[model samples]
Target: MFIGVGVTIAAFYYYNNPVEGESCHIQKENNVAAFVMYGSYFYLFLQFFLARYFKVRVNADSDKKKKVA
Candidate 1:
């Protein structure tokens, strides 16, 4: 997913900007790259949070069963 986002953003920039001119274009590309990277990282964090929540629920259920037994 991260690679896909990066490629899509890169292709958009490459098609819209000339490859042979202007250093500022590089800066714009860098900004886009940074955004994609951060967005991907944020997505991973959400996934981690969800997984942890589910894991805690499962452990609580197991502990409850052990206590009842």
Candidate 2:
């Protein structure tokens, strides 16, 4: 994931700016790809965090109490 994001960032940076002595500029497709990539990563992280930290636990014996004679 880190490598993918890093490469995407580098590509986006290179394409989004006009290079010196060159006519290279950002393209609509590249911009869209970058946005979608980041969005997907955000969704992945959100799902992982929710499942790992907010998961519910079931206890079947919680209602049973000890009787004192």
Cα lDDT listed for each candidate: 0.70, 0.74
Residue-by-residue lDDT tens digits, candidate 2, 1-69: 777777677777777675788865557687678779887998999999999889895554664443331
CA-RMSD of model 1: 6.0
Q: TM-score for each prediction?
A: 0.42, 0.52
Alpha-carbon lDDT of model 2: 0.74
C-alpha positional error of residue 38 in candidate 2 after TM-score superposition, expressed in Å: 4.4
Question: Model 1, 1-69: lDDT tens per residue?
Answer: 667667667766775775676443345666677777768887998899889875645457779899999
Top lDDT model? 2
**CA shift at 1, candidate 2, in angstroms?**
1.5
Task: Report how far off residue 19 is in candidate 2 (Å).
Answer: 2.9
Query: Candidate 1, residue 18: CA error in Å?
Result: 22
Q: In model 2, which runs have C-alpha deviations exceeding 4 angstroms? A: 23-27, 60-69
